[model samples]
Target: MPIPACPVVHFELPYRDAARVSTFYQTVFGWQLQPMGPEMGNYILATTSTCDSSAPDALRGSINGGLFPLVPESPLQQPSVVLGVPDVREAMARVSAAGGQVLGEPMAIPGVGDYVVFVDPEGNRLSMLQPLMG
Candidate 1:
């Protein structure tokens, strides 16, 4: 079979209270929430699966995710998925040609990569990320 063009590298959830949301995910799902400070936007990394000493090498389809504050005025305030792409600009163009509207210009996320969000024809919001290469 041919290779996949892109895969979902991560997922995210929105919250008002970082502590409460982190604690809730940890308590109910046994997930580990790693705190990130203001420079990273006070986000929380939710380790839902892993390939570490404690957990077995994760299978092909599983992924870890993060939680961030809900920006009340943002076009994508709801829970959204982040899709990995080779080029953010190209992806944005393809999304438009495919009937989706790119919400805004691509923004560079420190330590992450080029990122932009969009809304599909059905009104579902999602994001695309061109991860930084080490």
Candidate 2:
């Protein structure tokens, strides 16, 4: 049996200036940006494509993302992709066994799921997410 596929479901970018970054993407690419409240770390949700909730696979091949404030001490303050997995812990173990470094423990995103950041062997930052089931 082949291993299950983990698809890139989202992208993230760090922004020094929220207003500038939000305006750039919105004006240039027509992305819809929704700024979250402080409870959500002031993250800006970027919707690059439309999807119908009532339809299955409505977001196939498309993804939405978030813009987070850049933290000087954070190594993950760079553009990265988020891969969806069935189990975040299992995926973290696999990443470590494959010579990647799991940065820290998984953090829960409200209404989303468990998420963790990691770095590949080549030092590329990425994340894995076990989405919450309805």
Candidate 3:
């Protein structure tokens, strides 16, 4: 059978030290890392494959993610996959019904759309994102 199209859109990981974690991945995997300023919460954009960062839509079967500062109080302080959903609110409800726990309420990213985190029944962390429509 063919693979389903609900591919993982992005991934994320937390780090106690952004520079150190960025360097580790860059050195080990040769992935490109772009550090965002304080306004973006010191997030590091990780480019895992050879896709062009300037035009992400050109890539196929590939994804990249960000490295965020670890927050002691946050449940999102673990590596997680961000699945693209058509509606984050609906996804949250579905997660709850499917024996998963939604971490918190969905929040709208400045230019992005709604995003929420969750933990599967087996306790693996994951996230859902509803991209901003054009």
Candidate 4:
């Protein structure tokens, strides 16, 4: 289950004001935004469900990602770069075997897909997705 080194990571939206932008996304895309931490009022990750709202992050009902405040110092690259895989767990192993590091664990998203974030050996941020059956 070794996935080739894909060229995409994720589509990141740069927001100057997270609260304002996150609210907009919640209404427009039906995405759920959870506060990253108390100290990070302006920092939040967009999700497909609220805490205790639905299936695990990997089993959610649809493809989804996060929303965070824009950091001027960070690199700028947004291009709908989420990679689709057949099995996240397997993909994670393949990635690791290929010298990649898992940025996060596989998350279920109800009937949508399962996914995880990782970094390649070349320092590229990416995500792996496996759509779940309805």
- Give me the candidate number with maximum TM-score: 2
lDDT of 1 by residue, 20-84 (tens): 99889989988889988898898898888764345466654677889888989976688888999
Model 3, residue 43: distance off in Å is 1.5
Q: What's the lDDT for residue 14 in model 3?
A: 89
Worst 10 residues of 1 by lDDT: 51-60
Worst 10 residues of 4 by lDDT: 1-10
Query: What is candidate 3's lDDT per residue for 92-118, written digit by digit as tens?
Result: 877899999998798887897888889
Better of 2 and 3 by TM-score: 2
State residue 2's C-alpha deviation in candidate 2, in Å.
Answer: 3.8
Alpha carbon RMSD to native, model 2: 2.4
Q: Give candidate 4's error at residue 109 in angstroms.
A: 2.4
Candidate 2 residue-wise lDDT, 5-96, digit = tens: 99999999999999999999999998999999789998999998876354764655688999999999967688999999999999999999
Ranking 2 against 4 by lDDT, winner: 2
Native-vs-model 3 lDDT?
0.84
* Candidate 2 lDDT trough over 10 residues, lowest sum: 51-60
Model 2 residue 51 lDDT score? 61
Considering summed lDDT, which 10 consecutive residues are worst modelled in model 3? 1-10
Q: In model 4, what lDDT does residue 36 have?
A: 69
